[model samples]
Structures are given as structure tokens and as C-alpha cells.
Target: MGDTAVGPTDLGPGRRQPLDPLDCGGLELDGALDLLAAGELTVTGRMTDASNATLYCEIAAGESSGRCVYKPIRGERALWDFPDGTLAARELAAYEVSAALGLGIVPPTIMRDGPFGPGMVQLWIDTDVTVDLVALTRSDDPQLRRIALFDAVINNADRKGGHLLPAPSGRVHGIDHGVTFHAEGKLRTLLWTWRGRRLSAEETALLRGLAEQLTGDLGRRLEPLLTVTELTALDARLDDLLDTGRFPLPSGDWPPIPWPPF
Candidate 1:
């Protein structure tokens, strides 16, 4: 089976259960006072406007320590137009999938049932750590190039330079994956600038492995997080990119890079 066909179970652990948003209060969410910075008090003070009614909170914790970030689901808002709350769910799912694939991703600190509804709590990342594409494309780092290629293969629509945060240890972590793997097509930010470039033996091998597993039993296993339609679309997108035998380029009018690293 192609990597796209491979089910979640095929990768490793079965699908992770959705986190209960309510369980986070005072514990993983509101708790952990010592881990926070001096100015930080509680989640109530940090709430910021996210898309729609959904709110995003920054825990005001220092960079080195794990900081709590909360995402609350709101209703009937176009900016937050996720009627099904699938976007939040999808973000969680992507983190889980990337973890299973051995990619370095920021894992959720906690998931709990909220007063509004199901919500998520995750580690706050440094807004300054993100590298702009203009800077990245100008660099001589082969590792960065490889990382960019990996982002392409994964259909990371929002792989803006700002999204790639370099930790104190120098490892890069991608964030804000709420809009990934839509049933329609790959639509979002553009990062594929190396299309048609020759793939190294290692790259070829990885793609081949991923393709074989993506659409088979593995796809079915991801059903809990992704609909069959979404999974099928994901597999098709990967297949198209692999067949092109080229690096991806900016797709549409969307800016090739993301702005405001924060």
C-alpha cells in the first residue's frame, strides 16, 4: 500500500481520543502558575480574538518553559466559519499524525470540555522564532531545504516562514495547521519553490513509502479524525505532487509568505 493508503494504525498507535476541554480548568490550563511569567495571571486575562467566536489565549509563559495556549470554539461566526468545529479538530489531528510520522510537532498540552464547547490547550510557541521565507530561501542550509520539501509533501498549506519556529535547541516546529487537508483541494499559503528539482535517493524513498501507505488501510484508520472524503482528497493531492516529479511552486494569488510572525 502507498504511504497515503496506510491507516493510522499502520503508522503506530491507533487514533487518539478527542480531549475533553472541561478537564483543563485550574489544572493543565488555568493551573501551572509557576511555569508562567510574572505578568501572567490566568487564562481569562490572555484571551485574544481568534477566527470567529473562537478565542486564542497566550499563557504569557517564558519561551523555555511549556506555555499554555487555549482555543475556544464559538458559533455562527464567518471569520470562525467552522460550523462543525472540524477546523480545531483537524489541527489536533494533524499534530497527532505528524507525531506518529516522527515529525517534530508541538503537542497539545491538554484538551478539555469548555463552557462553550470542546476546546484545546497547547504549548505556547515563541512568535519570534519563525523564519521568514525571504530569509529562508536566501540561506545555504540544506536542512532547511529538506524541511521545506517535507512541508510540501505533507500539503502544509500554511507553511509560512512565520510558522516555522526554531526552538532554543535549534529544532524547528510548524504551527497553525487548522486548515489542512480540505476536501476540495490544497488551498492556502504557498512554499513549493523547488518543483522539478531532482529528488535525492532519500527523498524518493520517503515519498514512495508515504505514498504506498496513505491510501490503503492507513487512510481508513484516520477516519476518526478525517472524513473519507478528506482522506481521499489528501491522498490525491500527494499523488499529484509526487507524479509531477518537481518541487512545488506558488499555486495562486496568495502571498508566497505569511506576514506578522506573531
Candidate 2:
């Protein structure tokens, strides 16, 4: 895979109480995970068809609890490309970068000690299951467009159709990011419909804002999570994108689209 910040160590507070099914989504994320450190977890046995041993879990801390997807470090299958035992950390780094870029496409994720040792935990997204991947891949919808740009910046190696989850509020959350943030140019995804297209003035403005943050807060936060070489490559990608002001074309030297476009 192509080669990936740092962010808050906590969220979730205010006397955690059991949440109503729909209420959790509308709740304020402002410090919504500070209490996750002391939660109890139970595995549900449900899982995705990924290479790693991922688990669906319910976390109960105080009277409050919610479902989360957990990926433990020890359970990670060995990969030929990525450094072993680092995938869980990469997953958190992806969320950190997504938040830094102000895309809000990744769900709130945290890295902590779990039953299977250290791993990443992300709040389960209650998605609008009716979203059509076929249409979404071709649509010019601004949100999807933003995700396309996000996948590029992170050098994401897998942007499968199932990873793009749309919620009722129109927010699309991207998941399964363990294979991302390589120091190399390994951006394989299903978001090339906008290839060669110029970014809107607004989009360019956001990119510029993110570039500025990378040098300060974002960079400092990321230093602990990624290698120096990887961070340097991220800066280079930002510069390249800003200079072009257009969606990138598939490189002739590497794979562009991810397997299983759906």
C-alpha cells in the first residue's frame, strides 16, 4: 500500500447515560469520548469479511453505552506491505487526518486497550442503507466529491463501495482505513469519475486551509503517529494538489482503482 496525525485522547462526558437509539446520533460530539477509557465491552460475533479479525461490540460506561467496531492489533493478519502491528494505529491516524482536513468523512475513532489487546474503536454509523453505490460513484454530489479528494490526500489503498456509508443527515462516513496512509503513491479507489476536473474555488480554499494547519497543530499531532518519511510525503502531496487545482489522473505507474469497485 501507499504510505499517513494526532488528535484528542478523549471525547464523551457529561454524566454518561444510556442513549436512545436515535438520540445518540444527534448528541453533541464535543468531548463525547473522554469516558471511553473506562467502558465495559462485549463482543457480538458479527464481523466483516476483511482479512483481520474485526468485531462488533457494545460498550457500557456508567449508564451509557453504544455499539462500536473494534479491530485489535494482535488480531491483524500479517500484510506484505504495511508494517506488522501498526495497522490499528494507522486507522486512528486516518481519522485524525480526516478531522484535520475538516472533511468529517471518517467517524469518531479512538485507539485504546481492548479485550484483544490494543486496537481501534469507532462509533458505529447508522447508515441509510438505501444509498446506491453505482449512482454515487458517478454523481457529482459535493459530499461524494469531497470524499474523492479525501481518498487521494490520504493515499488510501481501499475505497471500496461498502466503505462509503451514508447516514440520515446526508453525511457519508468512510471506514476500513487500516490499509491507508502509506509513504508511497498507492491511492487505489473507486473515485476517478472526476479525474482531470478542476476543483471548485471553495474546495481549493479548504485545501489551502488544511495545508496551513499541517504545519502547526495538525503536524504536531501527527508526528507521534507516523514516520517522518510519511509526513514528508503528505506535505508533498498537498503541494502537488494545490499546484494542480484539479482532480488527479490515474498514474500510469501504479494501480488506480481498488478491487471490487462495488
Candidate 3:
């Protein structure tokens, strides 16, 4: 991660989540990001639920002890298709794209060199564990639907139920976006409840706005993280969603659902 990236700088606490970035002791999102970027990372635990290398770490920036997940680039296992030491970059890119789409779904994340090597550090979200995600995925909840559409736009290959964390304020936040924005049709998700359903006009407008941003600012932001082919494919995905105007069917290349669904 040579890019020296900052995260969620201007974001104020607009969402109703339990812990908003800007709500912590009146600190700005930029302050939290600076902590994640330059603070001393103390690895506390291992997040074994994820398929890749993930660690639960506490970042100490002065008096603040911020909890975050640290995914080091050196810990990333090699993939036959994707390049090496790139998953952490992709995770930061996902946060940027989500911010560009005007969604506060992805938690604050930044790219920095940690104890393990160059990696990503993202704020730990406190979730409502009592909510039945299986039930949520089976319903017509607009929250899940929006996330589903967002997954399609990014060509996310993994949307496991564990990744869909519901906040205390009823908003569902998506995390672990390492395997996303692929050039090929590699979408494999468990969110198929609204299959073939037409999107609301409001949602359509959001998509249109996202498409516009892709051609300009979002494209520039993702250039360092993703390849040119991936960007072109992302553009094609926006066009495809606009043309179809409905929930997409799963690509037959792989199974629609991820293993160990929850």
C-alpha cells in the first residue's frame, strides 16, 4: 500500500448506527482514520470466520483505543486469478466506492503498514446479533435489497450471511469486501430474495447517480486498487443493471450461494 491513503475524512455521523465514526468523543472521521493509519496496532485475536488472514486488533492513538480488523497484505494467500497483496487494497477501494455511492454501509477503513506488513484497518462495527439474518435475507427488506444491488454493481464474489451485519439502528452494513470488483462475472451471494423484482424509482435514481460517478470521480479513486479491465467491467456492470432494471439472476459459472451460509 504505497498510496498513503486516508479514510472517511469528511464523514459526519449521519447514520443511526450504534457507533458512528464521528460520534466517538466528538472526534472527526479524519481523526479516527489518522489513528488507524498511524497508530500502534496490538493484535488481540484472530477472526477465523473469514477465509483469508484476518486479525482483531486494537489501535492506540494517544488516549483512544480503537478496535479494528487488520488484514495484512503479506498474510493474503495467493489466488489463481487475482494478483497478490491486493486484497487489502480492494477492501479500501470497496469502502471508497460505497462512500461514492452515498451509502454509509462500509465502515471507516484505511490503508497503512501494520505489524504484519502493508494492510487495511477498518473500524469494528457493533452489530445486532439478535436479528435473524437468514430471515432477513428471505424477506423483501429494502435494506438487504439495496445491499444486494450494490453487490451486483461491484461484482462481489462473496456475500456471505456473516458479512451482512445489522446495526442497532436497523441499517445493514456489509463488510469483508476483499473479493470484489472482479473483471469477470464472479458474483456469488446469498441475497436472492428479490429476484426479478423491479427497483424503486428512488433506487433507480441512485443507480443512475452511481453510474455517473463511476465515469468521473469513482473511476479515479479505484484506479490504484483495481486493474483497468476491472474498471471497464465495473462500467459494464452499471450499464447492465440500468438496462435490466431488475434483480439479476446468478451467473452459472459458479454456485449462487457461498458455503457455510451463516
Candidate 4:
């Protein structure tokens, strides 16, 4: 299940509403990142439906307090295909890529020490409850198109509809990025509306910039999070995408979409 940023509309008559983004001390990008990285983290609750131990947390530094999600390394369940305890790093790496791409689709995320140990901590995004996620997933929304492009570059293995958080502010935020940056072609997602379509100039330019960055700072930062082989595969995927200048058609090698997609 997606780690939804809970709000009043999502709760029943008596259930406590989780902090709204404003209630969590509303900070801009840099402030939020600093708070997530250096603040005192306190566990507030857990999302039991998540595959791993996903903790809801409150982080405060000085007077800035905000709600965040913490996924501890030790809490990670062993996956046969992925290296043990590496999901947190992958999540952080995904955020780095998103930031480098200038796509704010990902929330401010960092790998930091939490109460349970080092893990991925990210700012919580309050969703617009009125937006129909299922309908949105199938729509040809431009934002989803950008996200689909991002997934292709990062090799995101999971991109279910439920993972999309349509924020009240009109921006979309995607979560649950642990299963990404693999060495193989594992780009499973719901945002395939542009499959085999020609890439726009903007999208192609973004890919070019990303390819350049992967050879510089972004590559250095991702080194600790992904294997050398995975990084090589990432470059190859970018090269292929740029070469084709089109969204890829499903390869038919693996399940193209995730089960229980929403």
C-alpha cells in the first residue's frame, strides 16, 4: 500500500488526523531537508500495511517541527533479488535523481539516523482527498508523463496508482521508491500512457542533462547507494531512451505492471 500522508478527510469519526503539511511547520525545500536530516526524530505511528516497517515520525529542530516517514534499515524484510538492507539507500538515491532532474515529484528525502537506526526519512505530503487516484492514473496528465519518464531513467520496479499523492497544492508527489535503480530492466509502472510515443523537446533535454550529470556529481552521490553494475545499466537506459527519443514499449520480459496496481 502507498504511504499516504494522512489528513482529516481520510479519518473516521473518532480517528486522529495526522498532521497536515502546514501543521507540520510548513518549510520550503531547504528548510524541510535540513529538518529531516538534523532534527530530533520521534516515532508517532506505523503503517502496518506497508511491506517494511514504515514509521510515521515527527521531527523538530528549534521551533520547526514536521511530520515525516521513516523506514529503518533493520526493519527491511529480505528480498531475494535485492541486497539486504539496501532499500533505504535506494530510496534516497531515487530522491537524488529526482532532485537532479529538477522534478519535484519526490518529497524531500534523506538517509539519516533514526530511533531504530539509519533509514530513509522524507517529508510527508498531504494529498487532495477529492482527486480520484484510479481515474488519475489512467489519465494522460502531463505530470504523470514526466513521472513515467523518471521511472524509465531510474528503473523503478513499482509505480502503482496508490503510490501517487496528488497534493492539495496541485503538485503530485510519488512515494515508495525502494525497488528502483536495479541493474536489469525492471520498470514496472501505471504511467504508460505515453508508451512508444515520441519524446517532447523538454523531455529529451532533461534526459541529456541527466546523462551528463550521471557522469559527474550525481554519479558520485549514487555510488554508495547502487552497485557499479546498476549504475552502468542506468547509463545504458538513458542512452537508449535518448537514442530512440520515445517512450519505451513493454519488453515482455517481466510483468509490465504491478499486481493490485492501485
Candidate 5:
């Protein structure tokens, strides 16, 4: 395994119930969200390469079970820029915005209490290991383009190549969204291939819908996770996108892309 590494199996005797095998198949989005929100989470392994502690866990509620990544708030290291211990909430916020846009670019994620206390639990996406990530980053994949639009909205500060998970069913999902939703203009990513391109009619329509949702339902949902200032900045970004009717060009204030692109 390279950047997108999976930990070794820790399943053995008396481990509650064996979870569904690592693959692209899983429950529907609603069911997956329920499973993650109510399941009895058992930490099975960890992704050592992650900046913060990322536990690969088995979540079981009755006969329903699945695999997910659990990032504990306590495990989050303080960042000079991001507020302390808010990474888990930010990750959940990213999922909410993705869902609101109807992009489904992020796997189902929820904020819940795990074995290690409160954390963000997301359905683990099994990616197609054969896909070359570097090549995929440079390609003009529509899925990646959708993600680029979503990233711009969230102010995602770290969208590396490794974050792109290409499923076997041809759907691309992005992960590791803890460092997103910053109030500043920190939209570093590898999906800049679509930078400055005119937004498709469909994309523009989706943004318009999202703008309305933000002021109504979506804003209420995100209020608890993000600050007032942050939410205001999000609205401003949306306005800029719709006003310009084009993808955003990189701001010289921050690095255009995250270091170690992969």
C-alpha cells in the first residue's frame, strides 16, 4: 500500500460479529448513517500515517455491522491555525455540505461517541487499489470536477491526491476532511485542473440550491459545528462563485496545493 494504506485485519474470535468484508458494497446512505450513529464501535486498528489518530473500527448494532474510521476529538493535535479539538466537527460539516450539494462525494459520516469518547465516524470506503492516483489527479474526470467545486465551497485546506478514493463501481469519494471549512482562503488541492473554467449549468443550479439551504436548514445544521464568522465566509465564497460564474483561481496568499501532493 502507498499513501492510501489500509491496516492489517485484526478480526479474531469473540469480536462481536464479523463486519462486512472490505469492498465497495455497503448499506444505502441512510442505513449507513444510522449504523454509524448507533453501532457499538470497537477499535480494530489504526492508520499510523495519519496526522491525527485515525482508528479503523468495527461497528455493530444487532445483526447490522460495518467498518468505519473513527477520529477521536481527544486524539486531535492542536493546529496553530485551526481551533483546538474541532477537527471531528469539521469533518462532519464537510459531509453535510457534500450531501446538501447532492454530490455524494463524501462517504456517510457522523459525529458520535466511540470507544475513545466523542469522534467522527465515517463509513470506510474501499477504493480500487489498481487506480493510479497521480494520473487520476491530472485527468479530466467529472467526478473529480464535482469534488473540486465542493472543495471550493468548503475552503478545504488539504485536498491531496491520497484523499481521492476511487471505488470499484467507478464512484470517486474523498476523505480526510478535518482541515476544512476555514474562514480564510485556504483551498489547496490537486483538482485544480478545472481552475477558472466556467461552471456547467447543472453545477450552477446545484450551487443556487445550496445557497438557499445554507440560509434555511443547512445553516442551522452547521451553526453548532462552525463559527459565525466561518459560516459568513462560506456564504461569501458561494456569492463569488455565482457572481463570477467560474471556478476560482488560486489566491496567492496561500500555497496553491498541499505539499506531498499525494
Candidate 6:
């Protein structure tokens, strides 16, 4: 295993940055609602196997009071993707980055006290609302290409069709970003079939802006969420992709999809 130590510097500002208890902005948890016992709340649910962290359902106590998913950040689990164990801080960091990039992702609502330990409460995405992107991409939709481009910029390792959840309101969302930004190669997923395709003038412009900001305040802010080695790896990956003027290609073997769509 790699260094799994949680240090002060391992917290950053992007969606992939680590979340510390100090950052919890006074969001108090009332009580845990047993969705299983109380069928009163109409919640369409399914188990997500891709997540190493166990998830459960509860009644949303905020403005949108309905069914919500609760994920507690705990110690290392045996079946985790990283042998050293999983960190809730890292998962929260990814969400923060996604939120900053204006990507459609399930943002975690930090709660102070709950049945489980320090965890995140987020809006529950309906299973029926999600569409299999692999099936949808069989047709020619330019938007799919745009999404792919964004995925590339973020260095997302698990951009499978199943990860794209389409809401009834005509919006799409991505989830499960635990394996991103490692010291080793950024391995996993299959979102790069459009290599060498000329990015639109607008897309090219966006990349330029993002790259410039990444090395400045953005990079400095994200320094806390990852290790020195991991952060160095991230900078190297970004430099290679942006400088080479080539769309990133899948580095290795076949069956490049992440399993158990959540």
C-alpha cells in the first residue's frame, strides 16, 4: 500500500480534495430515519455495488424533504479498491471538485451527528432516471462528445455509460470517483474513443483556462486532498495531455469499464 496517512496538507479545494471535520459548516443532524421501517416515504431504491463504502437511505430533513442516501466515511474496509483502506475525506474532495467544475454529480451534505459516524447526506438519484450511456452513444449525439471531453480534462477513471445518470428533467450526472488521482498511473474506465478529434474552438479555450488555473490557486487549494507524490503525478499527467495536444488514450488492457454501477 501507498501512504494512507491523513495529514493537514492532504486537503484541497477541488471536488477530489479531502473533507475535514472542521469544514462542516454547522449542518446539524436531527435523527436517523429508517427508510426500511417507514414505507411512508416513496423511495425507489437499488443497491450500488461499485462503492466500497456502505450506503443507506434516510428522510431528507432539509428544504427537499424526501428520501436521501447517506454514506458514512469510516476506517479501511477489506474489499476497498485501495488496500490501505478508503478515506471519506478523499471521496468528499472529488465531490467538491465536481461541484466546482459545474459537473452534474451528487453533492454530499455534511452532517455533524448521525447514526453512522461523520458522513455525507445527499439527494437520492432515482434508478429509473439513469440511462446506459453505452446504449445511448450508439447514436450520434454531439453532447456525448462534449461530456467525454470534460471527463478527459478531469482525468476521471470511471466514465462508463452506466455512471451517467439521466434525470427526468433532462440532466445527466456522474458518480463514484474513489479511484481518481493516484501515485501510480491514472488507470480505469473507457471514455476516450475520440482521440485526435479537433476540440472545438470553445473546448480548446476551456482547456487553456483550466490548465492555467490548475497550476495556480486551484493547484495550491487541491494540495491538501492528495499526497506530494499523488499531486506530482497529477501535474505530470495534466502537462503531458495538454502539452502533447493529444486526447488521452486508455493506457492498458481490455474490458475497461468499472464494475457495479452505482
- Give the top-scoring candidate (lDDT): 5
**Global lDDT of each candidate:** 0.50, 0.74, 0.77, 0.82, 0.82, 0.48
- The per-prediction tally of clashing pairs is 36, 16, 0, 0, 0, 14
TM-score of each: 0.64, 0.88, 0.88, 0.90, 0.91, 0.66
Which digits, one per residue and each the tens of the lDDT, describe model 6 over residues 1-262?
1111122222234333222212122222212112211222322443556445546554533343444554555623553344343444455445544444544453343322234454444545554335556666454455566566655554556666666655544545555555566655554555455766666666666566556656775566556556777667666765665676666666665244555322
Which one wins by lDDT: 2 or 6?
Answer: 2
**Every model's Cα RMSD, please?**
9.4, 5.6, 3.5, 8.5, 8.2, 8.6
Kindly report which residue stretches of model 3 are placed more than 4 angstroms away from their true locations once superposed: 1-28
- Residues 132-212 of candidate 1: C-alpha lDDT, one tens digit per residue: 656764564564555566556445556655556555444455666666666653544434455457777776665666666
- 125 Cα displacement, candidate 1 (Å): 3.5
- State the lDDT of candidate 4 residue by residue for 1-262, as single tens digits: 1222211111112112122354234677666766776688889999988999999988888988788999989999999888999999889888878877877878878787778877889898887899999999989989899899999998989999989999876777789999998998888999889999999999999899888888887787788888999999999999999999999888699898987798
Compared with the true structure, what per-residue lDDT tens digits does model 5 show for residues 1-262? 1111121112122111112233435676555666777778888999998999999998777888888999988999999999999999999888878877776787877787777778788899888989999899999999899999999999999999999988877788889999998988999998999999999999999899889888886787789889999999999999999999999998898999999888
lDDT of 2 at 169: 70
Which sections of candidate 5 miss by over 4 Å?
Answer: 1-24
Q: For model 1, what is the error of residue 167's alpha carbon versus the real structure, in angstroms, after optimal superposition?
A: 0.9
Compared to the true structure, candidate 2 yields what TM-score?
0.88
Model 3 residue 158 CA deviation in Å: 1.0
